[model samples]
Target chain A: MTLLSRRHILAAIGAGVAAPSLVRAQSSETLKIGGMLPFSGPASIEGRQIVQGLQFAVAEWNEKGGVLGRKIELVLEDDESNSTKGVTAVRRLIEREKVPFIIGTYASAVAIAASKVAAEYKVPMLSGGSTGAGATDQNTAGDPWFFRSWPDSNAQGDDTAKAIVNKFKKTKVAIIHDNTNYGVTLAEQVTRVVTGVGGQIVSKDGYNAGEQDFSSMLTRLRGLKPDAVYIGGWAGDGANILRQAAEIGLKAQFVGSGSMLSDDFIKLAGSASEGFAVATMFEASTPNPIGKAFAERWRKSHDFDANTFSALGYDSTNIAIEALRRAGKPDGLEVQKMLKDGMKDFPLVQGPAGTTAAFNEKGGVIFPNFIAVIKDGKRRLDV
Target chain B: MDLFLQYVANGVVTGSTYVLVAVGLTLIFGILGVVNFAHGEFYMIGGYVGIVAITMLKLPVLAAIAVVLLAAALVGLVAEAILHKPLKSRDATNSIISSFGLAVALQNAALLVMGPQPQRLNLDVSKIPVLSSLPTDFGPVFLPQQRTLIPLTMVILIGVLYAVLKYTWTGRSLRAMAQHATVARLCGVRVQSVAVVTFMVGSALAGIAGMLMSSIFFVYPVVGNMIALKAFTVVILGGMGNVAGAAVAGLLLGITESLTSAYVANSMRDVVGFVFVILVLLFRPQGLFGKAAERS
Candidate 1:
């Protein structure tokens, strides 16, 4: 009866006008994080593994009451590892979904392309698996908007070089990598390190990704007879190279960049994977208690053992959430700043050694790389 | 000299696999007049079948290959019935579009069932008694005994196929149909039946190639796409409907790739192969074996 009066309606309208922040406050009940990955393409395996990590972390957070008492929702768009698709996916995540935070892009090229879009939109995009140096290079214009949870290619390459020179004692090393940005950059870094450490570089070869035949390369490498062959590529290619190398009796000790640190590689390579050493951020054998707990839970839930990929993905998600909690709100710009300046010593949910995940000025997560070997068909930390 | 010979040996090993894939594609194109973009998916399915047979069913290598061939043949027949047969009478574009759609669908379906991870077929052909007795090395070339078996297997398959096409009624019918479908039908060759046989035979060839290469390459859904593209290149270079031409072209392409990778830069392998194809096409637009009138 009272609302029927014009004066009462006017009074209610006045109250609504006075509480201008009410609409903004109500919309903050759920935090959205966009995910960009090649969920249905050649890189789909990497995408699926990365998502498991993100899903596990997000689920755990939600179970314990998500950050700031709001549920975290992941909005995933398949990039298919194409740069154009990556840009389009990021645009959708930012403009259409309006997600404040995003995590994505196992492939470095996709990460680089998508991060530019996220940067232009002033949204924070974190990559859990991309390690191409250019992914988070401050030399680039859009580096501020991108943060990575994995060590850069240089870190992995340096670790690989050190392992080759110290453990394998291979002064003459051959470098083989895919033609992608990640592969080329890692190969270059490894070459530099191999040369700088008083080691000899035998030959550097490049192969297209997804190429099954490496007989020619293996035969040529066998002729060179390098002390070791360093692979700057993914698990799939690495496994193939190892198999072919064994088939051709290349005899070189096969070493790999961080990308080769996957159960898929060991499984694919079979007996050829024996004694294959790789530099990785997460070694399941020497996982911290937190990592151990995460891996066990991941295995139980996903029915697959967590690899370095899953661990990095879970840690990246944890890092994003930590930054959000530190920001005290889901503002994208604020979260980006907090991720860059505030998360220097933040303890990651997963790390290979005792070190915590720390982002440098370039927003790359810095952690000590450890050497792992596929021994007896299982990846084990060697040192 | 040994290194050069080694490269040649590597080339032959790779060439034989290409021959199998290219011949299958050419045969399908010859009879069905459909490029069958999904031809590669058959190869991928064969790899997966080989994996399952060997790992899950614990079958011997030869037995697993047989299973793969049968599975691939069945897949090809089903695909022809469901996807190709309906559009066979329509404009050629319809068949192309339908085949393309089938390729995408089959690839995604494989991804769904097999997941994105690559699985290796466990075939220790190197350990087989007869294969192991053969020299794994040829001069300076360190070819695996298992790998040597692949070329030999391809030779046997191709010889059997040649004999079938030259001597058998079904093969003759399929070849007649490949030359001219309407004429083939008018001659009471049963074009539809020939189409089925063509698809089966072509798919079996691809399946064998997949089984042989799966160990070397590892099996994933997208694996077939690359091999299929290479096969297309072979098909074009050899003449779309020319099976023998495809075999020759496939070997040529493989050897070119290998020699380029060995003597030049490894990255130049595909480039050289494609460039050679373009050169050949420019000189012979109807393809190496296709009739000049067929160019119309």
Candidate 2:
């Protein structure tokens, strides 16, 4: 209760004034964005492409002045496509890094898990290549914080059907999938879309992941003499399908989901994969400056060519930064609201010219897609 | 009928590879009386070596393969010196725990060195022709250059192993030690050397499988667990201590799994395979070809 000296009080007041600016400077200068993707485990090959794309986006944005005049820092954690590990990783990003935005959780299951944490914090989260529809389907009321740059599974399947009916001109098609949520959903979508358009499914088969030989399925397919075969899978399973099909004497035209659009696929299937076609979220030669830029940057950085997710990653980050700019701050709630409004329209260097992310009352990116065929062991426009 | 034939074709391709891995596994276990838990790691290591040789170093596929096998042999030698020799005549629990630790270490090391991404490799030779007589409707079954080499390699490997075990003094000593350790040691057979050789053979096989698989399946760090599980299954199915049984059981298991995948829902095929294994265990614990003494 004794009276403090006037000089002591002034000194304490000066310290308080000095600390506030320091805190504000630290907070306003850096915006931390967490990235969770399968950098290892089964999907790591594709996951690496995803990570590279994300990096390219961040690099481009930082070069142009980061979100809201602050440097955007990306902190990546490997989920390995394990749902449990995904949740743990997102939790670490949220609680430890205090990231207001997250760019990934590539597999649908991992995305579902990570989005739970994102929903809890009202933070904005987006994915490049998870097409299970489960990633974006649950929010009938429209998820405020969850947005995706890639088309939904239903869209992909419909696109595949379009290719089959309009392009392939085939009356009967066979669908073989890995039976995961992505595979089965896409297969079902394609089946419905194809049959709806007067095309019949000659055969359908589902296989397990890590499956080595698809000869049995291929054998059945060969006997059906179907005009075409659609495979929906990736990694070890996807590669082996082509390998086994070649061994089993299957001559039908092969089509696959986005999962087939990997460099590893062509390598594993060898020359047998030359005539395959796939529907993917992106094509390296998207005829867009943004797509070209991302592709050029990526090739310079790694030996692998650009895949669909790489372009999506670039677009997703571009949208995130746009929202950040509109919000004028990296606050999760402010950025979430801005993103939901879909304010900016910067054409990213990915696929066909597209505006900034526009949500159709649902938290999904209404981005255009491409159907590329593997000709001569490379992905080229089917046309 | 065509579909069935196709499935059989698929099974044949996969079963052939299983035969190769299983045979190598059984040979080591038969002679050493020790389970090399790190066999799968050796395979993974071989894959990495091949990738580095071919992709980064730009070596021819065959040279890369040779380099991988050579590296694998060296790794096997190291395993023999450290794991097998040290554990010889020691407690089973100690060796099991130690070798398990070694396997885990090797897996992590692989992740560290290779950066945890799957890499691709192709066969040096062009595609093989498994059978040329099938009709055009049979489609174009790949006789992947690797598939043709598998059987030829298996024969060469078996013959070499047999020659080493049967004709050479080293081969005779290994058999003598395996059949009766005390008497073989007393009769001037080098028990320690034979055990070391067994470790070497087992590891080298795993490595060869790993390298060869890169041609058929993509290779990555997680592959160790996969190869380990399948190889272990093959060993148990054929009788853990029966070399010839392992070779046959592996092919049988591979074929059955392929057939299951084709006929059943893809996911359920794994369940069916496990179920079959359980049924087999319940009925004949010694496996299909396992003998009385070889039964584990």
Best by the lDDT measure: 1
Where in model 1 is the C-alpha error above 4 Å? A1-29, A138-143, A287-306, A349-358, B82-84, B126-133, B138-141, B289-296
Q: How high a TM-score does candidate 2 get?
A: 0.85
Question: What does the lDDT read for residue A301 in candidate 1?
Answer: 68
User: lDDT tens string, model 2, A180-232?
Assistant: 77788778888988899888998788776666556566666677888888888
Give the TM-score of each candidate.
0.89, 0.85
Residue pairs with colliding backbones in model 1 are none
Error at B243, model 2, angstroms: 1.5
- Tell me what TM-score chain B of candidate 1 gets against the true chain B: 0.95
Q: Point out the worst 10-residue segment of candidate 2 chain B by lDDT.
A: B127-136
- lDDT at B292 for candidate 2? 56
Residues B223-245, model 1: lDDT tens digits: 88888888888899888888788
The chain B TM-scores of all candidates, as shown, are 0.95, 0.87
True contacts kept of each: 0.71, 0.65
